[model samples]
Target: MPDADSNPGNGDGREADVVPGNQGGRASRAAALSVRSLAVRSLAVRSLATLRAAVDRIIPADSWPAGWEGGVAEYLTVDPISADRDLAWAWPELISLAGRLDDEAHRAGADGFASLDPAAQDRILAVVAAGSGARSFDALRRVCWEGYYASSEGRHPAGLDMVGFRGVPEGVTPIEPEPLKTVAPAVVQAHYDAVIVGSGPGGGVAAQVLTAAGKHVLVVERAPYLRNDQIRGDHLHGKRNAVYWPTVGPGPGHPRVAQLPDGDRVLDGTDDASVYGLNADAVGGGTRIWQGMAWRFMPEDFSMRTLYGNPDGASLADWPVSYEEMEPYYTKAEWQLGVAGEEGGLTRRMPRSAGYPMPAMGTEPSRELLGAAADRLGWGWGPIPLAINSVPWDGRAACVRCAQCIGNTCPVNAKNGSQSTFLPRAIATGLCDLLPDAEVIEVRDGTGSAGVTIMADASTSPVELTVSADVVVVSAGAVETARLLLASGLGNDHVGRYLHDHRTATVLGESEHPVKPYIGPGHSVATLDHVHADTIPWGGGVIVDLMGLLPLTSAGQPAPGVPGWGAGHKEWMRGERANLFGVFAMGQEIPLPTSRVTLAAVKDRWGRPGAALRKDVHWTSQQVEDGMAVQGARWLDAAGITDIRRQGGPATASAAGEHSCGTARMGTSPENSATDPFGRVWGTSRVVACDSSLHPTNGSVNPTLTIVANAFRVAEHLVAEWPR
Candidate 1:
């Protein structure tokens, strides 16, 4: 029998109890009891020997499976293990280590790894498991863990329900109405019951609901649409066109700055036109570029004061409402967004009201191996709840299982983004009008009141328009929305303050087996072990699959000490692409008054004041690094991998720092937060800022679902307060 140490618990930290050989036992018990006992014991011993032999044939016995696929052995077959130079360089070393283990075991009169004493087995594993040499055992471990938990077989052992998923609240149907025909261009200026700025989650949902409520709505987007066949059927190009891409070097267009080591700052403000990461400027905003991993912040997340109380140097405060208050809205977002997956698992956080709209996406084979390893480690694993349709739902088709879903738009409409789901339905109701490529430069104060001034290209000629209404909604995302408010001087002092982003760190490795990485959603699984304060004691973090790599992005941004190009580089790329797997440790960045967005002296193509984003994240760096290391290690152990490589610490820039928030926070007092609980701008009656800018803190999860839910809450308030 395998020793207790060898038999680790599942990812959720539960003992693994595999049913004793029942392949044909129940039917043939009577005939084979006596003879079967002896044969079965012999077979068990032999099978154990074979497993050991296999382990010894490729790599060190101590180096167990680190990811979903089990180990480096399994990964090499399915993915590109030799692509990464470091991984390839370590291949021979791993083989040699395996041979040494086999020799050592044979000298001890053991046929294979299983025959060796448990202590000896552990000793042998210790050597290669240290992963001190050329290859990154840490990276391998992460891939194996991710691959295993993401597979069907692995999901089963982890107690993940692959088939059934209870989704959002019932009785909440899409408010679909009739479509309004486009008005004649020359007709008197068309009137609308409401005009929504920005076509992201909040704006999209608002448009759909208001139009369904029999009100005429106009949806305005600053970026041009990139759907259909205009861009070679690749959604990435569309995303690039819509998102604000920053330059690589210091340039006139660069609006952000990063402080580096040696006390010198590496100003990203280079003249190079190559774009870096930022929020999407298209109709769908960040949703078009997001990986679609949806998760609800724990009940405790909203009430930080009630849970851990306030901490110094942070703006931690309890939300105006509790989880129960937003519970119904959460369900509404789930159903409307068409998320797919199971609920009610021991490892998950949120409660479910009904099953998912469709089945879960297919699991990768690598996940199977990692699941087994996790079971041995006594950790719990669960199906990843995602905002993606696994089957046809509400006129949209199912996902095609592409590996490029990360940092790129879905070629098919399977991914439930605002553009594909809410906006279309809202447009179908003749009550809504979509004005693409219309940039609102300022929110013109309507003679001591609130209104907006918008600029757009009418037939490629600059056209300016003024809109006056009883209510004005601002949903221009965190950075842009804050800039717009500041530019218009609506609330300049509060507009660009308290900017925050989820600080991110990464771990990468090469596994033993092939993990077909590009087949499913970029992130099909995650671990929330440290997502709450109880786990980290000081701060919290969330773990998700690493974003897929584009060749240029990967080569250009190699990990420290990794060669960029050459024989070594080519080898590294080959292995890294196939066998490599990564993990992103995302932690909530505390809201700091110093970290802010400001208008630069420069101007954009539209002659608007260019927004300069300044981030000083040193305050929360220590907490983020510590939390990530802990959770990352746990995942590695669960995947049964010993070798590992990690990058990101206090010194590293927060990963992308793209999910920026808190520029216009929400609170009861205008002195602290920028808006009220109902998203109403303080000191104003009919002006509301309904976007991520209202987030008090960038909670340790994706902010989309929360943004949408809060928007619903705000809409309800607006309707209630509407002039009778």
Candidate 2:
């Protein structure tokens, strides 16, 4: 196929050379001819073929469409080469195994490796599916299936629209006449009606709403704004900023904390040997660096206690409000955050007053394959609801489907994170002020209220600025917010307590067909079937995008017998990019009182106590494990995968921290919780804790949307009670 760059003028030239054959004369003929030429050239077709060949080598033939030569391959091939390479390198042994399959197929009288009879194919593939093959083949197949089907072609075939396909929504204009180019001083003493700490979904939205309401607002962020030029494509470079500290396990520079086997006293930020998956010190916080998924928790997710009662040794309580109270806020978040999708679908149970502000983003081959599999299984599969624009909504352009949606911010303002949705609008209102590079040191109690003391900049000279407000909202995330409360001596006893995160594990296997896994979103389009169950006590599971592993990062995966690096490693690495998928379990963790985050002996660059987390997920409940197994089996069955193996036992340690929540929880009573139902701190009448810190219990879905909705609810209360 001709490269996209090489064929820039091809379409235009074809259009100009068409002969008139209709009543409309030259114009009509030219249009028809152009379309015919485009069909004949089949640039898209060839690209798809290449992608199919790559994916087929990774997954089973049953996981893909009947004819693998369709648009799935093209969609997979359209992604960035860097992403493709990363997906390929995750499973080195899969590359060698695929080669063996080819040789075996040739010996078995097959036209090509993937074209063998189902029984014979399973026989050869079996070597890679079980035992040692389980790890390599499972990883390759999962990644490839996810990567290919989640692409534009894959999504369309599977019946989902592309996100950010057109222009931004009508009437919502871009912030006109940009703000002053000069950076504001690190500290400002100007009094405002509201002061929001942390510029994530919670704070950003608060700033916009309060500012628009004519209240003077100030947004304080610990990190500076990241520019487009600063973004890196290389995984190592991305890791420096994206990955949490103490990159290597049990190494020096790792934060230390005490841990308990059972639920007892917990500390925040110090436990969990894995790299925490939170946002960097950037303007948008986690929003600037997160997978673009936006899902509303099920109704049962909100009221955990009312439904299942409380779990033994866990603080699993019902949310103060039901999903009904937050329904409008969900809509508000979707429209404001620029979600793209069909409102009605079997998987989508929420009621919408209006359709998506924009159409859905295009799908890739991986999504299509999964969709097909789901259809075959008679299961529900819809476009993964996302905070991405199909046609530009709220002034940002639609996504080009660069295939790097997870872990990286978009260069174009396609992904609707805090920066794209709220910061700009907040700044434009002029009623709001943002102070970047300002880190709050402590929240000292004043005569009646509390005053925030902050270190303005990185300069040697210490400059302290105090701001007293009638109300203070801490949206600094679960870890930072808990640390701040502890540092301030406000709720030190409960500050770092009840640290929790999703207990994640991966199930992998390989396929007989090409899956072309690196084409679109980096996560699964279809969630696992065992997500909902009121009677059964279990955390839910979701299908993840194929695990895209870069060469340097691939060193982390020992994979039982595979060597770190060698000639065999390099050969395996070549095919590793497009061949893996993991059924990632974002299982709800049973919050133990012992899990906590406390002040570490070590300090950050600002001399403030760095958070030391002490987490204990070693006692993950059987319910979670059962749920994971159920979903894992279903996903493998749908994908027609063999030789499946589950990584990490029910009580094993995990490597993710993005879904961590509930260090400082919200409840009706202060003795049982850290904050009030309105998110206000227990003792303080004015200070409120927003962010995931206020989540009493972490649900199975990504917490950002819920966080935003709760923030809106908090903002509404504040606005209603404001001294008008």
Candidate 3:
């Protein structure tokens, strides 16, 4: 047979360059028809050949298409290895690994690895997998699997079909993309009444309020306003996919240094899904791809310090403003943003002034089974409060109930976020100037007016410009907010202290019968029985059904003791796809003073220092998760689910995760907090810290809803007391 690499158009090597994203592999089959289209020039000819050979052997043609045919070669050459800054260090190592394979083939009396027969290739790969290069080989194998399973653009059909995924229904037409109308840097004015230095929930709400009040507002965002399709991707490459870089997350040119629990400092780029602290960086922030679990902080959540009494060195503190003050705003957010849920079951635990704007989503088999389990366990269960539309209420269509919901853009524009709800309204008022792709580096506190120095297109063709604003609201998330304040010589010593997020525990279970979890929203039912349990002292978290897993995600997660790759892993995936069910408990993370965000020594693409994060979760958080996990296992067992596997403990490693907040907490005094009760920085009169950075303590659920409610409160306060 002719060498595969030498003759690119050979039988097996025909489909080389067409790397498609995962759209149930239905559309990917057409995409993976050619290899010459992809830019293989960057990779050495010999190295590319070896990669193809290695991936083909790893997932050889066994009734299904081989790994190389599923666009694994393109995935390896085009994505993280060549383009990702965080993984740039691994490029040379990967190249070396490829070279090692070729060298091994030479030792076996072959011209190169690609020239070897299938059996010979498998033997060489097996030898490497068990030898010194095991780790590197494993990494290569992981990427290959991701490529084959995830599909770059829904081009690989075999992987999706193997897992029984019926791609987006044939007749389902996606909602028309509503692109943001933004102000170009060249046309932006010098000053505005108020400038919000972030476009997340906090900044979006602030803009909506300020703009509605007829105040000229400038909303500066670090990321570009991505269209609906751009964010949708091929379903497998969104915010939830941990291994691959997400669509809404920060891309190349952005980097951060994270200090691990073992005290080792590692350089991480914005694209490093796990290490760099993955959060949505686009206009909507985390809300763009959030699961839409709209939850309000319980009344008792406002007084963690008063209730818990600072146990186990946790720096717990009560919010300066109580839930009573925030209740109206929470209502406003739920109604204005179009939340869908029933208030009947939640009236006692989560007291609301008014009912949800829309009714709860229809019950499905998964929810019914879980609700039954909760009933049997004597737990209080209810429809999960969602910011997704159950009816066509807010000019957007209702959700199509697609399997891929969380971490993905809603195909129907039903999932509400800052981008979908607030920013659009803010822009329509003609008073808001939304500038996307602009990074506000510093807020210069002038004697007369506040000046914000912004870098337009910081990633490519950087240009620095200083624009003035009467009030500068720093709503740039917890970490970035602290970094900006620290870098600009603003805020007190208390800035960047007491960082935390919801300590989450994911318990996966396998049911004997088909639960059909991949039918609608990833999660449907939830139990709040543990939110403030009497048994445990520190307060437990909400136990909800976990998001549905994509084929790639499932492929990456092998059950404990199962091999990560090879035929055994493949068989396990095929059998477990329909049976697997997940339960997630989001426990409260006790804020610790030691956990913080500061400036890193490394510079970004624009020559500015990146943020340095050191996070430490309290031991009490572990106890909370342990309690939740036990309840979760019981619930699963009640539902006749077995083979339970629990993951996530203490949240020490994942403290800087999606819900990271409280770095610049608000309180009564500057001695204990970075900002005042009204979210105003203690020293800076016109500058305010909005966003979850002002969260005194993270609650026991997803923080986006609370962040939205608080942003409404802060924006109202600013509007009432604008410096005239």
* Candidate topping lDDT: 3
Give the winner by TM-score. 3
lDDT of 2 by residue, 1-724 (tens): 0000000111111111212121111123344344434432442333323223434434323323321332334333334332332232342434445555566667878655556655566566665466555665555444443343232211332201111111112342322222322135553654556667888898988887788788777777765444533442323224222121111111111233333354322212211223332334466776775656787777767776776666667667777888888888888887788777655442365555556666666766666766777777766666667787777667657665544555555646577888777878878877777877566777754445556877654222446677776567788888778888887888635666887766555666555554644344445465535565442255464554343333223323424345332223323334442354445555676777767777777665556676766666534455675667656656666777655667545534322255667877887787778887878777766677878887877776678888888888888787777632
- Give the lDDT of residue 196 in candidate 1: 79
lDDT of each: 0.54, 0.56, 0.74
TM for every model, in the order presented, reads: 0.68, 0.69, 0.87
Tens digit of per-residue lDDT, candidate 3, span 1-724: 0000000011111111112221111223223222222324434755587877787777777777778875675555443321232233344556667878998999989999999998888788888889998767866776666577764443554677777664354478887556888988888889999889999899999999999999998999988767776666354446555444455656655667778767645443323455566577777888787768888889989998898798867799999989999999999989877899987545567666898889999888778899888878877788888999888977888878877666667888888998899999999999999988889888976557887999986544668888998899999989899989998999898899988887667788788876755566667888877887774447788887766667776676666766677666777767755677868777788888989988888876567788888887678887887888888888899999888878634334444677889988999998888899889888888898889999988788778888988988898898899865
Model 3 lDDT, full chain set: 0.74
The worst-scoring run of ten residues by lDDT in candidate 1 lies at 1-10
Per-residue alpha-carbon lDDT of candidate 1 for residues 1-724, written as tens digits (9 for 90 to 100): 0000010111121111111222110213333343333433543534524333433322232223212223323333232211121122223343444455555567768876556765676565555455452133323332222222222111221101111111111232222222223332232144455667898888988877777777676677766554422221121122321111111111122243232233422222211111223455556766765667666767767776566555666656667777888888888887888777666432356665556655666676555644455456554554566788788787765666655454445556566778777788888887777776566777653433455666654324546766665566788888777778777777636677877777666666656654534455655555666767465644577765554443323433455455432234434444554555556677766666767777766665456676665656544545776678666666765665445667534433332244667777788777767778877776666667888888877677778888888888787677677532
Error of 2 at 303 (Å): 1.3
lDDT of 2: 0.56
